[model samples]
Target chain A: MSIRSLADDGATLVASGLTSLQRAHPDLVAISEEPAYVIRAGATPAKVALVSGGGSGHEPLHTGFVGMGMLDAAVPGAVFASPTAFDISTAIRAAHRDRGALLIVKNYTGDVLNFSIAAELAAEDGIATETVLVDDDVATDLQRVDGAGPSQPDSHRPGRRGTAAVIAVEKICGAAAEAGAGLAEVAALGRDVVHSSGTMALAFRACTHPGDDRPAFDLGDDEIEFGVGIHGERGVEVRPRAQAGELIAALTAPVQEGLGLGRGDAVIAIVNGLGAMTGLELSLAHHELDGYLGARGVTIARTLVGNYVTSLDMRGLSITLVRATDRFVELWDAPVRTPALTW
Target chain B: MSIRSLADDGATLVASGLTSLQRAHPDLVAISEEPAYVIRAGATPAKVALVSGGGSGHEPLHTGFVGMGMLDAAVPGAVFASPTAFDISTAIRAAHRDRGALLIVKNYTGDVLNFSIAAELAAEDGIATETVLVDDDVATDLQRVDGAGPSQPDSHRPGRRGTAAVIAVEKICGAAAEAGAGLAEVAALGRDVVHSSGTMALAFRACTHPGDDRPAFDLGDDEIEFGVGIHGERGVEVRPRAQAGELIAALTAPVQEGLGLGRGDAVIAIVNGLGAMTGLELSLAHHELDGYLGARGVTIARTLVGNYVTSLDMRGLSITLVRATDRFVELWDAPVRTPALTW
Candidate 1:
């Protein structure tokens, strides 16, 4: 249900969704409707305007945070697709009350390309712009495709793969913007948020987008797929489904090893829902995580387990680990007034 | 876990859970720590202190609402059982700070009996007390005996169910307190909230309390128990699992009929989670609801679908419909912050 696939009828539905959203949240939508869409609490322009958008389905990520502390304006795509270059440009234009705009994009090909084009358009309009791509998903970074689907020999690379890390970017960048940081500093911080926060997911089933007649990926009823994307894309591991705790352990093994988290090291762990898992399950997963980390001698000071970002109704859970330095924790604790991430 | 089922080892884990909850939310735990406690904001004595409680597993319900604008205090039982008479009586003592206390109990047999005893104790202490039973669940009121290790034919009755409608009482009651409404008026309003609210549930599985390792009732993997209660008690219809939309309609049917929702009717529908559904799934359910009501020619003015009340990790959902009048909507819009039900 990307913008590309959004036909006249679907656009009307999207319009209806937007209308419903605006009607339900007039004040929130009002903030987004501002001339320079970011409402920074005063007439004074923000030194750095953090503008971000990609898929439409990832809610409260950009739009919900468009207030005093977080993002300026969020351009939404239909579902999992990237927003048009025009919409991104329009959002940039609307948010850049200051001299520059900072764009945060996921590392997906369409999102990166679209944001780059938007930045170019913003530059033409004399608004300085910078872009940061979050690539923190272990599965994608280690992707080695051999001849047989995901079993390709070269399908294993070791690097950052992005998942729920964009949430961290929205939070940190939002706080940085509110703190009146400059464009360069905010852009750098946004990149760092992406650079630091990493996540990996395991799906019991694939997602079916709106009007999708079938699932995007096939998963046996007894088996689980590890490292699937938010779009229900296949992952690195398609092994037999293990016990819930063992499943979490397998997902965390690569993440913990990659982060080099030692004994007594404190980190911020997020147990995110791909879509279908309940908060209770997420909390249970967190309970298991506490034991898992304890068995590994790791210390976790702050944790959040909920459906922050989703992959349309996919039945899966992701383990996101953000190395919580003092500053990162401060950013995390900063007040946010989003529709979803309220505190 | 129930207090009875807790062996020394399991009791330790349960205690640890409470400890974690207390540490994470001190103000929230203040209501629970006292076993039964009262918290008043204003210096002036109120007419009736509002008190509510049930089991420990349902977070934010009885405990989360304790604050200036909500419940004076809430008593906690172990898991899904009723609070002890002593605990309820103690809470009354703590809450009877010159004003009387009103005990709001859901229509659970144990809760009714326990709170009634507590009320008698409070009256003996010269603290006047009133009790109101919330029987909002449209589902069967009693447990079904499979083979019945013990036959209790009189207990399990049909047409008794409850859900998040209790949240409305905390809300309206809080407003009543703010408006300095008298005890009679508040009591009447509390009853009105129940009268206006109708709830029905669909369980994916059964609920098991402490001491009962087995579910009160069991369903096959492909089964969906309609008209289920919070306690994982048996439901009315044990139908095979269907699509989420169909399941929601099944639950909403009783609610719509009870509320007498008509075409062009404006209503506030809360697609509440029984225990385990994620917020995202609830939102998706809301989306379905909007479509359902739209097709039915009903106009939904406000929708608050979330895990307002839960039944441990029971995988189920309940739909609570409060036939919306403009006044209730305003009351809902009224801002009052508390531990869980913050505006």
Candidate 2:
């Protein structure tokens, strides 16, 4: 018997996958490029409608918050591809049927360029469109780390890579929207989150398209890449794989350095799976996380341990630590529901 | 160039694993085989203590729920192996140090036998230990497919397995303990859950131990075993691998027919990973769950889509459906704070 490829968006896979997802979790609604969704505020007519999208793969970041709180509309791109410009603009228009729409764009070239052009076209059509780029990944040099041996922030120090920033932005911005914060507040928080965030990943092997069976590259049974991205992007280092403690240290060095966490400052840790890693493994990584942070005398006030954000089926973990001020912790606790995430 | 093992308690995996589990998720804790957990309820002495344990492999179930509105103590067995009578006895004695204790035991041979012996031992010391067995797998035949379909209960039915029963019992009994339900009520509900519940698993291949690189069994690249156990038991059927939908249908048929899930009845589906299955796979299976339930006319009111209960790095999935009533739904909604699970 031949193995049915798991990487696909054919009606069969989508339909079966949705059923399985729903069966496993009733709260999540697995939307596809089919029968798109649009969001708008109830009761009072809201002043702003926000639209964001890329693909069916990047889940909770875009669609998970498409309730009355976060997004007015989210245009899902094809799996690792971009959504059509028309789809983006149209979805924005639908969500903005009452309020003017704003586009929340990530810093990816394709997403930025496409959403930016779509924003312009939507603006021409009389809808207010503002595009914000979330270049939160320090892995790609998003932030200048403040390095003092995990003791101080240095603008000149090498920075950590980006991790778990989208979660903070979507969650905080979504809460702000629910509390009637203006577009300025939402966009500002989004910007602040990106500035403070960093992520880096290592793909043990590359994932091919749905119909493809063979993996892109093979590693020794005991090999792992470092500083990789979710889309099968090669890592900064392709050293042999080590234990979770070493892996967490490698991932956390940049984060702790970039943020310059000290003994008193509190932080939130997100040990995210790149889709392929098991939740058990995700749970298991927490061991490395607490030990590393505690040994350095860092305080972790709040943590989200699970696959809050996933990159298809990439086999890796990304650590995103946010400096937890009182306000950021409040924002993290604000509850919003979507298919990929919930309170 | 070294491998990690669970045996070395002082090793990095053990040190960080325990630290991470405790720090990030405080609800989870490792009690000495003695099960010494301090509980303070308001100002009054605790009235009843809930104690549960089996093996360490099932994370959130017995251990994660030890924080609040759940178990007061959870003694863990090694990896996929059973805890000794001493561990169970110590946990029970400690929990009963100031109050009576209730032990929620899954219907496994080692667990049942050991917990029973411990209960008897506890009784000798004037501490009462009530044991409830959860045996909910309806997909496998203790004998063969010739066994009863879902219609018959395990005692009468032929193929009874254990998978999703952990969640159902945890939900029901956790709520009962929260509501101050008596030992009788908690035990009764636990038994009811095992009686009403059913589970089946599929494995792509057998899992090797932590230090072993190869699987215990040899399977073709495309082959997967159906009706697999959590400890990598031999599957009842080893046919050519099929689509997730077809596999799900095969898994569900025994339970649906045995339980008689008519087109009009409501149910809850749990698509669990047998350790190594990826979230992408779970999400894809989740897609299939809705369609399958809808086709059978089984209204799925509640679904949990994750690796809530997993086998050790086993690449398989188990589908569990509880015959839903208003009560069961209410139980599921009841809030319980555990290390691995929460509402």
TM-score of each: 0.75, 0.84
Give the alpha carbon lDDT tens digit for every residue of B164-252 in model 1.
78887777776776567767777877787788888887776555453454556766756777777787666666676556567667668
Candidate 1 residue-pair clash tally: 19
- Judging by lDDT against the true structure, name the best candidate: 1
lDDT of 1 at A69: 61
**iRMS values in order, in angstroms?**
9.9, 5.1
By summed lDDT, the worst window of 10 consecutive residues in model 1 chain B runs over B1-10
Error of 1 at B305 (Å): 3.0
lDDT of 2: 0.63
DockQ of 1: 0.13
Evaluate model 2: give its TM-score: 0.84
